[model samples]
Target chain A: MDRGKISKWLKYPEKMGHKYSLWAIYFATGCGIMEIPPVLTSRWDAERFGVLPAATPRQANLFLITGYVSVKTLRPIVRTYELMREPKYTVGFGSCPINGGMYWDSYNTIKRVDKYIPIDGWIAGCMPRPESIFIAVTKLWMMIDKGAATGYIRYRENYRYYRENQERILGKLDWPPLYPEKMGEDNG
Target chain B: MDERELELFFGPQHMGMVGNFSITLKVRGDRVVEARANPGYLHRGFAKMMEYRVWIQNFPLVCRINVMDPDPYELIYAMGVEELAGIEVPERAKYIRTIVMELSRLASHLAWIWAYGNALGFDTIGQWSMGDRDYIIDLLEFLTGGRIYHIYIWPGGVRRDLPDGFEEKTLKILDTLEGHLPEYDDVFFNNRLFVTRARGVAKITKEEAIELGATGQVLRATGVKMDIRKLEPYAAYPYLDFEIPVREDGDSYSRMMLIREEMDQSISIIRQCFKKMPKGPVYHRVPNPFKWKVPKGETYVRMESARGELGLYMVSTGEDKPYRVHFRPPSLPHGILILEKLLKGASIADVGHIMMSLYIAAPEVDR
Candidate 1:
């Protein structure tokens, strides 16, 4: 509202920019996708938090994996996660993504998403309320501020371990590497 | 000729598309020669998963089958169980079930409106529809605990009676929504630009619609009057009266018009339920849910969801768990078969619009 605000932004535009403008990809993997309409629209208005839906993974910094992740969907989830650039953040919405919620024993769905891809934060509910989504986004800003959201770093350092776990379930992966190869190991 | 045709995957992660489903389009220039819908991106193996859970446990799980309209699944499951178990629902509970079910329909149609606008690049209408849809969600929140998945409509009867002054609050919300309808008509529904863009964009003939197994708004928009509510009345619909909105054009515009009018009808149906509602307990006492078992029998029950005819077939061998379960969701024809047929010979620009207009939700297709 004032020049002071503009001056503060001018000094640390990168930090403020990353904090203020978090664009989540409009990708939904589960039933929790229903909560997204109210959050993004005029109802709960998640845009007031400077959050909006990006059309693709390449353009987005914030990723929300809503609800349960089935074995079939996990491949695309990993691909979508890899598509995001550095300084990216991920928020696993609903209890399904955290520990599979009611679908814990489901033959197809993944019990916990963290085993494959690192999750920065989790909102636990069968379907979290629209207001709770905004609170999660606010908390995400705090994580970004403190630099505690190192999911990307973790993904890089432990790519081998994550890839092995993924390969065990999704045998004989067809796609090529997301990150460049190392010298010692086979590219496969 | 085949060499000229390029294949592209219109992915699920797209903003203009509905749910986690994709379509592989074979296009030459800008016109699609063939289309194949790729589902299973959102499949949680719903029918397969349901067999493992006991009857009561399956109630909450079935709502996830169609996120946009969860009640009809719950209704069908409840009805199927009621049929097999020979549970007679109370009169007043039927009325309450009717009201809540129609409210779910209204909420879903609002969602359809948002999807249509989003597919056609009308952001303002999408926002307006979603914002308006929240009023119904708020009412649902007051009545049921959950906003998205109510799980309120259960076997034997509903989960709870109407809340204190709920009828008055519903009337107020309906009136407020009714007042805003004219403004909506001016901005998006009746706007010349929107009409011209959507009219005759994706046409489905009446004969083809029926042959292709199309129902709900898809068939209704094509001048066919086939509704499960009128044909086989369930819950309190037999006591209540409502008209099915139909348009003969069988195009995207007609479907949009029909959905808009249906919202008004849903409001009316809810009103009628309230007016004719007799005061009584909402739910009938039944055996313990965990221990509840049906006599060895097979039963099929159907209901009219926001999408269309939703049916559930349950088989029991005198056991608490279902021996077999199958869902006849409208999305199968509406999403995969009808979508592939409709996308042929259409411009790439109209692909998303046509799909959304058909109300092809991915979960229903995959499930």
Candidate 2:
């Protein structure tokens, strides 16, 4: 622990704790996952920033949607995102997740991942460098400090719209609605 | 009397999985009775997508088809376009292309080692290999702008010549990797636990390998002695002197050993490329990307990628875009066909081990 931010540690210990230990789901969404091995291992060493790969979504709080989300993968993404506990933050890792990057007109890939699921931040590049991952993590820390990284909250508030967006691309999802009470209005 | 079977879905989210690809296994007790490969999670319709993009624009897109090893896709695409348009690559570019492809093969094999290690529950090898892979990635970044997707190999030749001191840096990295091989063997390959676990698991006979379209290490491990570089030479492979390492066991251990041996071959190939590279223009400029129209013809070009034989069949019809583009990635057979066959009687514990030994890159299968 750094002595420089003693007051910060005292005032909001919980937020500070969440800020550091961001366990990301080891989910390889697309080509962007190519950079992940280097980031996690001895080269870039993301563990220095307290970011480590979680085996499952339940164990992870930080979800880095690594690359383009094809329609086939969207269902699993939604399921994984829903499985994570509250205060989970999602960072769209490449240009593809923002607006499809090079695969803009791909027939099977969804253009905006945010339309299906809320993203707290975006790392812009065809495939962002491993160093960019560190930058994104630091930026996420700032967002968390300010209480602005609330994509999970936003997701709950607007679950209907996100579901609608997902249903538009993928036909009726196999699983039940995550928030059943919120689904009382339009049961479709 | 009747027997009950458990339906186990093992991927798309499992830690033991290769990537987005999944397999549905019907298991009785600890042994798998039947296995069905489920792909398309990473599909962006690459072959169809390539048809819509202009000839020059597809260079960047092709490499994304295989995330583990991308340079071969670039080389095959370039070869396809060059053959269609009758463009001759400069002699220097040929050597440079060879060096880049072999370097990519080295990097990909290292990545495979990491995956294989991880699959076998040996996290130590995974850490070491992944860290070692970064050095090669650094070399690639120095030569090309991008680390993962190096859109360097174009129709006529490479995008640019080697940067100053690139040769020296490459040789130094090669020396470092060569020195570390023995340590890798001691920790992972030759370890008693690894040998016992991998020895007879998912063994493939020579006939099964050939019949099922297994290529690269899968085919080579079966004592068949088939290599695209040796059989159908490409780039500067015709000039380089390297042996194709073959093992008779056709087991998981044999495949792993073949990968280790191939890394040595790749290093040697790169060294030969640097020694024999002629000094000249690295690229012969193609016509403007927006206005260029290739002649009406279809050409099929294949090369030995790190995984296996990667082939691309491209057709141009006097338009700015290609009429048809099809890629035969090695993972298709290894991941879907061979995997399903091999998993029939394998224990649940060896699912990941067998998959890694076959070296299935999920993106290649889905793409």
lDDT of 2 by residue, B284-347 (tens): 8889988899999999999888888888887889899999888898999999889999999999
Candidate 2 local lDDT, A85-165, one digit each (tens): 988999999999999998998999989999999999999997799999999999999999999998998888888888888
Clashes of each: 0, 0
- How big is the positional error of residue B277 in model 1, measured in Å on the Cα after superposition? 0.8
lDDT for model 1 comes to 0.87
Clashes counted in candidate 1 amount to 0
Q: How large a fraction of the reference contact set does each model reproduce?
A: 0.70, 0.76
Tens-place lDDT digits, model 1, residues B180-216 = 8888899889999889999988899999999999999
What is the alpha-carbon RMSD of candidate 2 to the true structure? Answer: 1.7
For each candidate, the alpha-carbon lDDT, in order, equals 0.87, 0.90
lDDT of 1 by residue, A54-86 (tens): 998998999899988888889888888888998
Note the DockQ of each predicted structure.
Answer: 0.72, 0.79
Q: Model 2 compared with the native: what TM-score?
A: 0.97
Query: What are the TM values for chain B, all candidates?
Result: 0.98, 0.98
